[model samples]
Target: MACIDTLLAAFAEVAVDPDAQLEKHLAAGKRVVGVGPYHVPEELVHAAGAVPFGVWGCVGSSVEAKKYFPPFYCSLCQMTLEMGLTGTLDKLSGMMITGLCDTLRAFSQNWKAGMGSKVPMIYVTNAQNRFIEAGRRYTVEAYAEVKRRVEECCDALVTDEALARSIKLYNEWRATMREFVALAGQHPAEVSVSARSSVINAGYYMDKAEHMSMVQELNAALAAAPVSLSGYKPIVLSGIYEDIPAITAILEENGFAIVADDMAKESRAFSRQVPETGDPLEALADGWCALRADTELFDPRKEHIEQVVELAKDNAAAGVVILLAKFCDPEEFEAPLVKKALGKAGIPAVTIEVDQSTESYEQARTQLETFADLLG
Candidate 1:
């Protein structure tokens, strides 16, 4: 329990400090690359020898960013641009954003104009048609350009060997995280909902190998701990983001435990590891194709819904919560279909809105409490 507590504390420290890694990299005179949500080829950033700091945006409303887009845009984009304009991202040598959705597509341009040569912005379009050969080729080329941009920013090259090593390291970390999530599920009493977020979110702010060592030890600790059969409702969470403060606590307050999640910021990012063989970038491209269909990408077969269903059934979840990021159009469109599928299957479910600067969880607590009672 002591070791587990230490690990959780360390991870929580990193997760709570938004600019810790960036400051460290700056102090060391190392180039830091800022990466926005959805899809970013972080391997390319690592291969270029720059730190890849996740930019989920600041947790407050941004009056400056309002100038670029309508008020309807999600807070993630709005606040990230706010940070960029407000000089919060001045330490980063470059930033990467994907055109995965309409808001992100527009954000990339707004960022370039706002920064105006202060920080270079790399633009990438994730191949939605990734199920096909042409799509794979297009993604590879897009990654190649990302590689070039990062290399230029760092004044270094993403060599094939370095890229291959980065891929291997990332896969190793992903495997360790996979082990942690599985163990966390079996010992929900110890993990707690916030502890789960700590263990997962902390990795984004540290070097992969460092994060791996910490998590590997925590996984071992969890494996050695006693299991509990508590009267908490277990559920699978599917959504664009899980960085909202107090979300896990709100669920725990309602006698619920998050056993698993399909959150883009969490498990979805590492659902499949890149294959170690062949070209590293190519392997990464293949790995993208293998990812479970989610709101960001096109799922011609609608396997994403089935993936959600399978997660709940396999985890024996009491229900599934589709935590939609507010004003996110793709996730908004998927809500009804998600509800319909789970409804037909006789699965308990709820859709909750989450934002970074959530001042209150009262409404969410009520919804989850109602769901828990219905399941009971």
Candidate 2:
């Protein structure tokens, strides 16, 4: 097994420099498709002989994107557009955008208008009512269209064999990630807050198989190492994204160890596995339909509230920290209910408003410090 520090450094390097990773793949003559936020069919891209590069917004100000979006729009969508407009994503062979929420729905239109033909845009619409027979059929057909578009864009065939292989690889990757999260929680001192985020975030910019191998090694290293007795305050995090180094730094300074999370960028992306048997497209659709407790998905029962409470209790977390992304309507709408549920369950929780452009984290530090005190 590789040294834990060495593995962590590798992940941190890749996590912070996804552009370099994209360039590296481009230099290798590999077709790269940019996948936007939420549940996207990355397996199709892999089967189509291309890299599925994540296009989650970066930490930066949105200048050019302002013309396309209002000030009230979420920074995540805005910065993503800014990257495309600034030619930062010019090298991408194609871009796949999902209409999971209102902001993302508008983002797709803006990306089409702004990027034009410089990069191909494949728009995907997911059915919110995903558990019914109609919804399942819709998912399969929608994903089939995505497969067709991906094949056309990559100039390669998404044959059943290739798709099946990709599905198996992704399922294995997901299972490995779930293992890593549990291991990381067991040894938080070895995996610092920022380090834990880096390891998971790195997967967004890397080949699933490659990232999984490194994580498997890291998991082994962590398992062999002595358990953490640091007595840090364990907490569960819920958010659209929580990979920001500054935010993690605050949690680390406040002596918080994230044992589990509902972050879309982390566990939410890998909490469920794709079915390995039967039709690959239907399997992918079933995987998406299986997703629960996410703000993007339709949950009329407000099950996410109880889910957060259960996660905190299950992990023995003293509290829950919500990294509320600014101007994200779905998360904003769901935050109150989650807080209420946690309160009823006797789980201490705090919400920190997060934005991509904000350089200052002093407010977050203060809030987290208070939260830490409360937990104590």
Candidate 3:
């Protein structure tokens, strides 16, 4: 329990104040790089001996970000750009921006124009048509640009051996995380939804190697002290950021345990480990190719719906929860499809509208209570 509490406290701190965590890392003489949404070459950053801190936007209305994006734009983009403009992310040695979505495409331009001087910027793109040889080549070239920018910023060459080592370390981290998520399910009575999310989210802000060690300890403790509850309900959370902190407590109070999620911010990011056998950069690019059905990326095939159904079945979940970020078009587009898929699979699901700066979750609470009641 002490180990659990300490890890949770650390995760909560970093989730709320990512810059503080990054600054602490910097003070340790390690360079940290900021990366925006969807896919990033974290292995490349790691290979260069730098930290790859996820720069998913904050929890607030970004008033200044309006100059670049409309009100309907994603808060993830809004708050991320606000951080760059406000210099909240100035401590980063550099930042990597990707053009996965329209908002991010505009954000890349805005960030370069506004925050590029403050923090050197790297433009990255994962090939959308990623199954073809041409797409693979394109992705490799794109990653080469990312590697070059990363090298320029750190003044180091990311050797094949270094990249291979990073890939191995990251794969170990991914394996540990998978084990952690599975273990979290067995002890849901003790592990709140937020606690589970935090343990996973901590990986983005902290060193993977260090996070993996602690996760291993936490998983061992959890496995040794498993909690059994006949009435505890398991569910899969599918969407982008499920970071509405209060919702977790409310869900636990209402008897929900998140066993699996297809969130862009959570499992989807690290589910595919970079292969250690291939040419390192090519392997990293190939990992990006493996990222499927993520709402943020361009996937006309929409395999995410199938993935969600499988997740629910595999977890024995009573239902699926759609924590849809309000005004996020991609997620909004996905919501109905997910609902339809779950419905067809005979799975119950509830969709709750959410935003970054939610002052109240009274509606969410009622919805959750109603969903939990239906699960019975």
Candidate 4:
């Protein structure tokens, strides 16, 4: 129990304070590359002998970023730009920006204009038609370009051997994370809602291999411990991101436990692993193309809605909660469809608007309390 609490605390600390992690790596003379949302090929950065630091934007107001974006911009992009503009991320050696959504595409341009001089930006454009052969080829080429840029930024050669090693390491990390997620679900009494989120969020800041070791230990501990008997209501959480303590606290206060999630920042990020027995770059491309049920990605058949339904059913969830990021058009467009699909499947769901700037969660607390009663 002591070990479990210590590990959880460590993860939560790193999750909430990414700057400390960045400075720790920098102090060790490591080159850190900031990676933006969705996917941006972190294997290449690892292969180039640099750390791939996730830049998901912190929980804060975006005052400086207002000059670049309108009031309707998503807080993820706004806060990320705010950090860069305020020189909070200036210590990063480079930044990798993926244009997965309209807001992110615009953010790429705004970041280059605002902070290009302080930290170099690598704009990565993924092929949306990724199921086709031509699309796979295009993705490979794009990743190759990313590799080249990463090499240039780190002043090192990204050899195929190194890339293959990095791919293997990342796959191992993903598998370990999946195991940890399952363990957390099975023992919600031991792993609180916020603690489960922090464990996953910490992966964004720490090195993959290092994070995996800690998670593996935690997983073993959870597996050995007795199953939780707490009267927590298990549910599936679908969102772009939901690491906000205020929001998660409300869920826990309302007796909710996130047993499964379609959140892009948590389960979605590790749902697919890079195939290890192929050309390293091609494997990376294939992995990225294979990612499913994500709002930022293209889904012509609206399969993402069914995917959410299936996720909830598979986990035996009492309901589904959609943590809708305010001003995020992709999630906004899909929320109704997901809710409709859940309704068709006879699953209860609630959508709550969330943003980084909001300090008050009273409305969310009330909504969730009502949802909890409905679930009961």
Candidate 5:
């Protein structure tokens, strides 16, 4: 396998200027809003004539985040909090906070107190659990609340037709993303690993139609590109944390490509919407149900295993890689169960635990090389 140093040096060269990318849209008289990990019906934001950027946190910048929130908060939340405190999110016209976890719920209140004048805050509850009727009802109420919040903050009436059109636009964007996934699954190098990951991440920054168009052009270019050599095995990247480039860099360098993934930020989410009806609220709820349903039921255990097995078999992934954060309790508890299942399925797997403030990219490279060796 290739050494980790060469890989890290190469990754440094393949950077994306996220700050510059954010500036481009902001200068065009567009408002940028932030959303966290829980699945957001971005259609509502789009219909309201604002741009919804999924704030996944800066991988190397979480040290600055610890000042506002406790270090115990997940890196994802910390990075976002740091960004808000530093006024990096000053360009944002507003921000939506998902009540996905305790940290985020606290984040909503802290952010409002700190940056409410510059960026408005909307708190949303997710419809992630299916068995609980109260869960579904809470989601519906939250959707309505989000709609109301956005409408009031933006000072605009959110009509049903606008929301439905927004849904159609986002749906197309989702289809475009799937096209990339299908291509990568079948032909990894036809599109460079980082390029594929970047396209998916780009969805958060631009309008749905514009983003979809960019992917289509990228897809056409990839389709016409030369085929990647075979004999390199496949791997399914799992666990709670993976930035697109981080996963792509490890896989491509080690001669193993990520054919599929179960990472919440990358693969598990897709376009979910409520139907276009006179009641925008109900339609929003219905859309969320369908979107989550597409990912499988809300049971964490079932969903995690299903993703690992399906990706492994369908893409012929040789092993699974759990790209987890060091102090993440939820993923830490679930790791053994997932590890055992992958073992029973005859797929070799490994874990690489990284903290939000992790400074050792070299360590990540080393662990990934070990994973590649295990697969061999």
Candidate 6:
């Protein structure tokens, strides 16, 4: 209980600071932890009283990261390492990475061999198989192992009550963030798309109460706005780590409304928290399994894909934009499949490749303008 209290207190400090977001909080004594893409098991980290930040590099710097990581390594890994080498990730005490793809597996090894400042590295398995029995077992084992490792890092043990409370708090936070996401889709300019994106992305790393406050502020701002059509080209963005709010801002300025998007970190991570339980670890394990099951490549429900199609259809979006991180295998792997499906649905789509250092917004603008023209 004391440990949970301490964890939440630390998170609140990071969340509400007028000047200190995660970058500022990292300077403090708290241990900064990193979680890779795919089944990060963040509930366990938050429960263990550690800060878990997602390590997708910010917009624009691929050319520099390329010097260190080979071309085979995905852009996401390169971006992460770029921050690590340049001392941006100095605040991190450790990293929790998964073997989500071949690039990630190799990058894990490089993290140990290459970086002079090696934060503690915790490697978790990324079950490639979807929701078969074997896959479920692999996920369960990974969740348990991650929970144990988080315990070791904090010198803390998991209590049933503490774990349950952490899960509940995080779930509430997720729901509220989701609400804010829907609001952003409804009114991008009114919400400050960048601030909403940062708050939700950083929420995964910071405390719950602080995140809740940020959401409340966003919700209040939305509620107070006047009602009207944005009078912009309706666009639905799809992909990962799309930090180029400049494009969205430009589109909005040109009377384009970013009605719906799947590119932002906040859009991807805002699911209900694992439910509270008498046995928190088991509950957490269940939550991880549930999320994986929902997002599995072959999910029979086809919910994720369906959601994308529905969002496009519902918004009557003028066109769909896909922003892929160069060398992001997961997005690369998923894009063609998504494009084909959406094409069948008759939604016009264009795909762009950008990295954390997105230096090509002008080129992208030309493409977006053309896409808008085609839709007309």
Instruction: For residue 250, give model 2's deviation from the true position in Å.
Output: 0.7
For TM-score, the strongest prediction is 2
In the range 77-160, model 4's lDDT, one tens digit per residue, is: 999999999988888889999988888999999999999668998879899888788988999999888888888888999988
Candidate 5: segments with Cα more than 4 A from true spot: 1-15, 221-229, 244-248, 271-280, 291-301
Report the C-alpha displacement of residue 239, candidate 5, in angstroms. Answer: 2.7
Tens digit per residue, CA lDDT, model 2, 13-117: 998889899989889889999999968888899998899999988898899999999899999999999999999999988999999988899999999999998
Worst 10 residues of 6 by lDDT: 1-10
TM-score of each: 0.96, 0.98, 0.95, 0.97, 0.86, 0.82
lDDT of 5 by residue, 194-312 (tens): 65566566666655686676567666655665656476767777765566455557767998777777767666665343455556666667666654322223555456665577678
| RMSD of candidate 1 to true structure, Å | 1.6
Candidate 3 residue-wise lDDT at 3 = 73
For model 1, residues 1-376, the per-residue Cα lDDT tens digits are 3488788988999888857766877787778888888567788898888888888886777789989878878899999999989888888888989998888988899998888878899888778888889989999888888888888888899999999999899889888988888789878788878888877888887888988999998888988988653777888889987767667777767767777788888888777778899988899899887775777888777888888888899988889988988888888888889889998888889999987655787898888778888877
Residue 172 lDDT in candidate 6: 83
Top lDDT model: 2
Candidate 6, superposed: residue stretches over 4 Å from native:
1-19, 22-29, 60-68, 202-205, 245-249, 292-304
Task: Provide the global lDDT of candidate 2 against the true structure.
Answer: 0.90
For candidate 5, what is the total of clashing residue pairs?
3
TM-score head-to-head 2 vs 5, winner: 2
Residue 102, candidate 1: C-alpha displacement in angstroms: 1.3
Per-residue lDDT of 1-376 in model 3, one digit per residue for the tens?
Answer: 4477787777777766666788789998988888778678888999998888888887777878888888877778888889888868888889988888777888898888887577988889877887778888999999999999999877778999999999999889888988887888767876778788778778889898988888888888888885754578889988887877777778879878788888778788768877779798999988887766777776788888888999999989889999998878788988999999999999999999878766789989999999999998
TM-score-superior candidate, 3 or 6: 3
List of clashing residue pairs for candidate 3: none
- TM-score quality measure for candidate 4: 0.97
